[model samples]
Target chain A: MATVAAKAGEAGIVGAAERLGVPLLTYAAADLAQVAVPNPSAAPLAAVGTPSVAEAAALLGAPGGELVVQKRKSAMATVAVARRRPRGRLALVGLGPGARDLMTPRAVAELRRASVVVGLDQYVDQVRDLLAPGTRVLESGLGAEEERARSAVAQARAGHAVALIGSGDAGVYAMASPALAEAGDDIDVVGVPGVTAALAAAALLGAPLGHDHVSISLSDLHTPWDVIERRVRAAAESDLVVTFYNPRSRGRDWQLPKALSILAGHRAPATPVGVVHAASRPDERAEVTTLAALDVTTVDMVTVVTVGNTASREIAGRMVTPRGYRWQS
Target chain B: MATVAAKAGEAGIVGAAERLGVPLLTYAAADLAQVAVPNPSAAPLAAVGTPSVAEAAALLGAPGGELVVQKRKSAMATVAVARRRPRGRLALVGLGPGARDLMTPRAVAELRRASVVVGLDQYVDQVRDLLAPGTRVLESGLGAEEERARSAVAQARAGHAVALIGSGDAGVYAMASPALAEAGDDIDVVGVPGVTAALAAAALLGAPLGHDHVSISLSDLHTPWDVIERRVRAAAESDLVVTFYNPRSRGRDWQLPKALSILAGHRAPATPVGVVHAASRPDERAEVTTLAALDVTTVDMVTVVTVGNTASREIAGRMVTPRGYRWQS
Candidate 1:
């Protein structure tokens, strides 16, 4: 190690130190593979409650199967050991925020092993280069979700490794549900999350969500406009930190304005609003303004908007959405 | 373009076609940077009713100068071009989910250039070796924020290019705030966002956050405990999607249980809940369960708990937190 420093510069030192840390860390993708439980039938008959805790104990040494489900006052419970190969097989993956560079090693690993890839247009586009020559790609729009679900299920049932790709972390507001809803007893699926846009954009704007905030999407596809609008109003009325996803569409530009009107009712017009578009992508854009000047028209499918809660403070030219951490402490 | 098939395969043609679509793409970084407002003293004046939009334009594109304040319907009256070398600089950066392979080219570029990097002990520790020889490392602990803030300010004012790094995206409950508060007018701070934990975990979970759901932090630190409780209850009551950050602290394990109690009000005991810990890292762990089986005590600082909204559905063994984009068309 000392000789390495003599031969290399600061970058070399960084490389050496990093290598040291890697060895100190215990890593086993296989363990995760084991935890990739697909069908409950094949899963060990572990009780769901305290008895399950004992089962969880037996599998403590395993990888992804350590289910830490915390009931109110109960002790932590671990699920069963993750099997190496479940009867069913499926994968949910995130493509990172707009850029291929931000995709995680895990996501890449899953993609490499996947025989069938299912995802939205943008997500598939980002990782288009990685798909194997004969890899089956399922191009999907927002509609026909059930079809995609059935397709993934059929592929998984056939024992093909499948992956459902989302642009952000798949668990947040994306495919985790539809995939599960569309699945049957015969399939196994594992999730691989990526960077979400709100977080990506918040990083660009100096931590608008550093503390407590509400993240809501202005898009009203499945949700009633009333419900979406009410949620926006509720977030604003509460003075909670807020983030807006799918804030506007060419057909629904007015939604943001009406939502803003609701926000203006409770939030000071000057509430800081951070807008980041194409986050993590080469052409990413970010801007911080107040509720009064939020331009709904400029934001589209690719944009994410974060509005400071009442507690958010603008300090030294940057915005900090206080999580109320200091107060709690 | 024909050879593109050789390079991009099926995805290449799809991407090329998508790029050419006649959609009204909104403004991204390019649009904002186009109008140079040199010397903050001179810049375009924005009209009222859209401060968030216009004020953001001024703050981002205006020359480094003293910000002028203004107030409008959705804008801030006090917006102006800033023209000055920042006395203290803040860079809100996201580290993407772990592996250097996942690091965005832009994110990596900024890290190599940073002179002072401040972040939580875990995050700082993760990237310690990535810094240059002279780069000062400041450990920012979640528990001891004041001390962290002071150090961040002190270092930046010392004229060091600082990288405030965070795991996932820096903006999502990461490093954006401390730098904002500690620095002053002289600091020249900027933000570099990375992948957010939620997104990374979601990717791992296969698009759980695929739709419009509410994101909330279980940590009561920066927020009133009552408020945290309220939001959790409200999110559940509204049958809205919910995510819990800082879900379980060694000292505050009870928060999760309390949250579950409220969430159970809206969701079934079988309502799906996904838990992700140390996502994208070699130590990454993930699983799926329900509100009934959720045990909050098992999670820690590294974990994110996502509770599905009513529309949240599971299919093909994958969970989908539908953002309802399909609801739009």
Candidate 2:
């Protein structure tokens, strides 16, 4: 809220408050000046007769409220969060597809803001330098996602700012599920989206995802093989471009080949298939091949395989799918 | 290549060049010193007899060549690009779902690197301040996607660094399709992936994309309604979460309702649905509702509707779908 309703409306303050389901409370210059804030400014005092609008207003509203978050400014507006007590913060941050620059600014900010970071060992190693000095990092080995989620929630419940990190979007086959499961309304949870492996591989292989597509992880560790195969068959029959995550490992090479065969049943053998390893990483590699010629032995846990739809094509060494429907002129 | 092969290998330069299928050329210090560069340093001259390693090596490798990109230094290395002739450069950048902080660092760098920026007028307005001081912007109104693509490609062909911007991941129903269609081998193209609408909406609504999911655009302006309906049906039957883009507009209000009905056939009426309007924007609004309670009239072109699968649930007012085949023990 602003001194004038028009200012609040034009500045989008009113709409933002409404979206957050919070009331828009405004105070007059004389009234705001009466509340003394820890952080006071001469500029605001001259303009609105108050050194701090956000802190003052929050304190006025919450009787004994404390500043949980100091004033942070963006290009458009200023934000300061206050609460009557210390609230735990949980940030599910996606580090993007292995590349440092691919990570969003919000994800980096969340990592810096957190007092504790919980993640897989490898993912934590990737962004250890990005963390703010003195951040407590709790890293675990692979296949312990649930444990890490529990630990993160526990840390947050202890009144710490916690960031649970994952490669790619944490919501997509990452840490978000277990973390959200362990969390309740007691903590403030924030999800910071990252570039998923499928999207990252698609960029390297060109625009294979230009049309409707589906991403299905090929790992059978959690999902039953029958269920996974059913999805593969459905994608093939539906003519949807398919991106397979956790395509293969030393002990599980057969799943990828089997999935490929299921897809081959519906798609032509000449269909364009993209195999990407460690996309955007130091050892990043990508190739566009056909289902019949791709070597399943070459794939590993770090790889992602994208099978194009019947309408997809490899043009100029890049896979592309037109956006229009097949019959569209 | 470096002064020594070990250095290049240790820095991952050799692997990166090999992955891109480019030759890694090397030059001795004396040979590199023969080439004159715009920026020279005394430190390099004292150590390697060359004032500039990157600029000198690039110039020495391509005889009679000129520097296209000047020497830029990071903490680990220096980079300089030289070509026999001026080569056109094109970067298809995804601006990510709406918030300025949500955009990737790579996407931001591409925008700053480009001499020309081509995008929709509204998207351009969102990032106007982020553009480099002298960037030449070519913004168009609605329904001119093809024109914008052509202009971006043309600018790249004219030997200018061009960035084509779009909301969300540019490859997913955005500018990547048309732009890639217009591009040829003549220009060097780079894709900087952004946070797509589906991912952005998913973040706001919790982990609905925790497992296999599909995104289908509901707009029939170019795609046939029959084709759109088929995808929706496939997602419904496959038990895949469905994210609908261009869900509704004033003119096309029936499609979302029709699509929802099709999804309702496979999922229960109590299935969770997430509706996010202008996600990450100032007017952002998100709600979790049941399929039966969702009002299609409340949706608009700027909205994204995510219909959760049979296993999805609204826990503590947040929509979440487990990744496991069944409920965890």
Measured against the true chain A, the candidates' chain A TM-scores are 0.70, 0.75
Clashes of each: 141, 0
Backbone clashes in model 2, listed as residue pairs? none
Q: Can you write out model 2's per-residue Cα lDDT over A1-329, one digit (the tens) per residue?
A: 22322234444777777788877877666676787767777867776566777667666665545767766668876666677656789998999999889999999999989999999999999999988999999999987878898999999988899999999999998889778877888888898988999999988887889888999998888888888887888788878899999999877878998999999998888899999999999999999999888998878989999999988877778887777664223
Candidate number achieving the greatest TM-score relative to the actual structure:
2
For model 2, residues B243-284, the per-residue Cα lDDT tens digits are 998999888888999999999988899999999999999999
Q: How well is candidate 2 docked (DockQ)?
A: 0.40
| lDDT (Cα, tens digit) per residue for candidate 1, span B1-329 | 11111123345344653687722212343344344433322223232222143334545543443446432333422323334335545565677778676666666666778877777888777667777788777775666665666676677776667777777666566545655766676777666656666666665555566665666777666766887776766676556667777888778878888888888876777777888888767888887777788666668988998887766555544456655645322
| lDDT scores in order | 0.64, 0.85
Estimate candidate 2's alpha-carbon lDDT, on a 0 to 1 scale: 0.85
Candidate 1 steric clashes: 141
